[model samples]
Target chain A: MKILFLGFGNVARRLAAIVTDEGWPSRRGTFPVEVVGLFTASRGSLAGAVDLARARAELEATGRFDARHPLRTDMTPLEASRNLDYDVLVELSPLAIEARGEPAVSHIASALARGRHVVTANKGPVAFAYRKLAALAETQGVRFLFESSVMDGAPLFNMARVALRGCRVEAFAGILNGTTNAILCHMERGGSLEEGIAAAQAAGIAEADPSHDVDGWDGAAKTAALANVLMEADVTPFDVERRGIGSVSVGEVRRALAAGRRLKLVCRACRREGAIQTSVAVEEVAADDPFSLVDAYGAILRIETDLMHPLVLTQEGPEVMDTAYGVLNDLMEIAGTAERKGEEP
Target chain B: MKILFLGFGNVARRLAAIVTDEGWPSRRGTFPVEVVGLFTASRGSLAGAVDLARARAELEATGRFDARHPLRTDMTPLEASRNLDYDVLVELSPLAIEARGEPAVSHIASALARGRHVVTANKGPVAFAYRKLAALAETQGVRFLFESSVMDGAPLFNMARVALRGCRVEAFAGILNGTTNAILCHMERGGSLEEGIAAAQAAGIAEADPSHDVDGWDGAAKTAALANVLMEADVTPFDVERRGIGSVSVGEVRRALAAGRRLKLVCRACRREGAIQTSVAVEEVAADDPFSLVDAYGAILRIETDLMHPLVLTQEGPEVMDTAYGVLNDLMEIAGTAERKGEEP
Candidate 1:
């Protein structure tokens, strides 16, 4: 599988490292994944298959791609995408939620139009244009799989797609964002919301602009993505009834604890009156609720289905590796090389 | 798909009903599933194609199979199995945990030997002869799937098999038995162990002879099945370091609760040193543990891997429908009829 990466950032770099590392054992020998092209907005793009380790060393010491580097090209990601011979395109660009999944959507649409499979870690395209892209992929007979989009590569979507096939997802409630969860945890430890945000930043859970985490846009985006893809609701982040924990006080947190409940930034989605209702709010959950047991750095998604009882999935402290492995798993699936079965390592 | 059912009990009856009920809405269109044969130890046997709804009425009215019942057979399960024409064999007989999975194992082995796919709800085969059956299926180019064998169709094994492909399992700990959990829950409410057992039996959580559940044999079987299939451990239920909650006293439960911990029957497996180690025992879990939140009627499995963070799966109050759906889901996967993608309900 020849892969074209849209960004050369942390997740993408780790993906390349894992794919290229011979010491990393994949089941049933190895999958033939070659990095044929790479494009970065700041770092120069590579037009053809090249060794990433050599390129990384050059980029670190020389600070830029010039005549010294092989396969270096001046073409933009769009131009290089058409020129390069690749089987799948992996998108790992940073989230631009404010612009509603901008250039990423355009890039994916272009790739789909050209009849190429796509694997992405971007939430914008899924949150903003899931219906349009899914319909387009269906018309082309190729798939648009983003297993890492919503839950940091926890395999929630794939579980719904494969193992739980024929079962309709009726409703879901989850803690999708790690940032606000950390802030809530901080508040439970006697810190105010302001101090909580700072603590989250210090722990690298909150980004420089904490608005997305505190203002509920992150959770709203994830909710919209899940609702649109799994629930077939053509909704966007803007449609969510959003609230955040910005108003939470330390005293309120203590009171809830005394009452045997803990505050959480809960994301919920369900169909009501023939339409999907999406919301992200801070609520007091009982001690017995699975949502209350997820650690500050963890996440949990509880889904009700037509065929089974209430099913819940949880994850603890996902890092870049989780998201990177998710993208790699998607690539393997798109390449139809995901035949790891009937064995133990 | 023509299905040969080895037993016509509650689970098989529900499966037939769900498959034939026109009012039930399955995703996409209906899957063509026809009951071709059934062999019950006491409920009688039916061979060839059967309209289960009509056959069920006849069996209830007559209470025996004779010339009046179409396709009635005097052959044993093995004899009828050889004469039947079917694509897959489904085993839903009573658990023969004490007999090391008994006749169900023989029935499944016969089906696999003929190069046919097998989906079973029996744990004995998997716990006692997983390596042999799996090896046989591989050599015959057939699959032996038993998703309902553990966790009551929570999709744990399938999750490890499909969604987490290429990832290696490092360790797992779970509350896998509902009867023991229910008993412990009753004890938490100031009930004695004897009272707890009576309550479990009264609530239908325990069978007439609840030894398999209370004595930890059921969990041990599931543990061995998981270890044998997922971890490549060739151990049986008898090999598990097993203990039961029958020794748990009410005062001990109260003491654990006062220390902010809960008593649970935890089934665990890990590769220790150079071999797989399996255990099923009653232990105290912290209040914040995911196991602590699982309801008396619920179950949870936490898995650690080398590729990603700790992944957890949970289910609440599973019933006959959950196990029946599991069998149906396995049938769909085996028939190559699980092509559900790029769409919504």
Candidate 2:
């Protein structure tokens, strides 16, 4: 499969390295994936089939990918997505949630319009334009999969879509943001809020700005996206009652710990009175709740379904590889090369 | 699709009801499932295209289904599975761990040899002969899906197969048995061991014998089945290092609770030195472990992968509906009527 990458960020670079690394044992053996195009905001864009391994290595060694390096082109991601020959588009651009899923949404929309399959790690497009882009993908008989958007590709949407058959997702409550949760974990350990944020940044888990991680926007976006896709609700981040970890203090964390509870930024979406009500709030969860057990860099989601009363799922280490695997997982599904029965390799 | 049912037990009866009940909202709309046959050890047998709705109602009311009933027939389930015109077989017989997955194994083997797809709630066939049956089904282009075996269809195998694509399973530890867990939960609540057993029986969660659950055979069988399917181990129940909840004392439970811990029957499987090692043992888990949060009639599975550190999953209410939905979920995947993009009902 010929692939086009919209952004050469950490996640996309890892994906390319994994796909090109012969040492990396793939579930689907030696799947034919070639990097045909790459476009980044600051880094120059390139088109035409290129050595993805070299591209990944160059980007990793340096900080940016130049169009003049080996694979030369002067096309933007949108232009490459329009004119380039590729089977699927990997959109890993940084989130632009403030603009209501701008350039990312437009890039994905253009790719879908041209009858191309899209795999994304950008939550912006899905957070705002899930219904529209999903409908467009269906009309075109192509998949628009973003398994990384919600829980860094820990099978959140796929679990709902494939496994929860014949059951409706009545409600869901989850700790969606890992960086903020890590910071909270630090704060719970008597560390100041600044120390927590700084620790996360030093570990390369949080962005430099850290506003999205400190504010409620990231969690709210995930909640809105989950609500729209799984809960069948047409909603956006603006619809969520948002709260962030910014208000949490060491004193409050210590108090909650003394009461055998943990304060967590939880994103909940439930159907009430026949409408989906969503919120991202800081709640004091009991010691027995799964959230209390979620450690730093870990996330847990509890889903209430019609058949199964409640299902809780937790994953640790929302690293760049998780997001990279999401793109590969979605690509396998789109390529119809998903693992089959009786094939253990 | 014409479906032949072997055994009219709680899980099978619930499956038939959910499939035939017009009022039951299905993820796949009005799925084309025709009951071609049903055979029970004591409830009798039927053949030919049966009115599944009326069949379900009769079984629910009478607790037995006779050939002379409304859906009259003369053929047994095995004979129907071999000779009748059917596309799929639903196996829901009682567990026969001591017999090493008896009659169920033969029944499923016969159906698979006949090129019929099989969906089973019975753990026997999978526990004993997963590689053999899976190979046969693959060679015949038929699916032998037994989602209900491990976690009563909480997506254990499906999650690993369908979602965790590029990663490899290094180890997994989980509380797989529900009835024994329920009994342990009762014991933790100051109930006597006998009372806990009695409560589980009264709730229909445990069999009248209750030995399979409390004796550790059930968890061992599940561990063996999961090891066979997921970890690719050719082992059986007898091979697992087994310990039962019957050995757990109420005083010990209280002590663990006082220490912020919970006693749980944990089934662990790990690939050590290129070989899969499995055990089902009672362990005292910390309050922070997800297993500590798993209530009576609830389950928690923690999977350690090479990519993701550990993925923890918990589910509550292991009722008849969960097992029934497992059959339906497998059937959907087999019939390829699974949810498509923008085609949700």
Question: What stretches of model 1 exceed 4 Å from their correct place?
Answer: A25-29, A56-67, A337-345, B24-26, B57-67, B337-345
Candidate 2's displacement at residue B222, Å, is 0.6
> Candidate 1 chain B — worst ten consecutive residues by lDDT sum?
B336-345
Pairs that collide, model 2: none
Look at candidate 1 and give me any clashing residue pairs: none
Off by over 4 Å in 2: A66-68, A337-345, B24-26, B337-345
Report the number of backbone clashes for model 2.
0
- Highest TM-score: give the candidate number: 2
Interface RMSD of 1: 1.8
Q: How far is B146's C-alpha from truth in model 2 (Å)?
A: 0.9
TM value for model 2 = 0.95
Kindly list the per-residue Cα lDDT of model 2 for residues B1-345, writing each as its tens digit.
Answer: 788888878788777777767765445434677777878787768777788777778878888776567566667666777788778888888789878898788888899999888999888888788999999998987789998888887887777777876677788898988888888889889998899999989987888999899989989888889889877799988899998988789999999999988899999999989989999989999876678888888888888876565788887767888888877888887766323322221
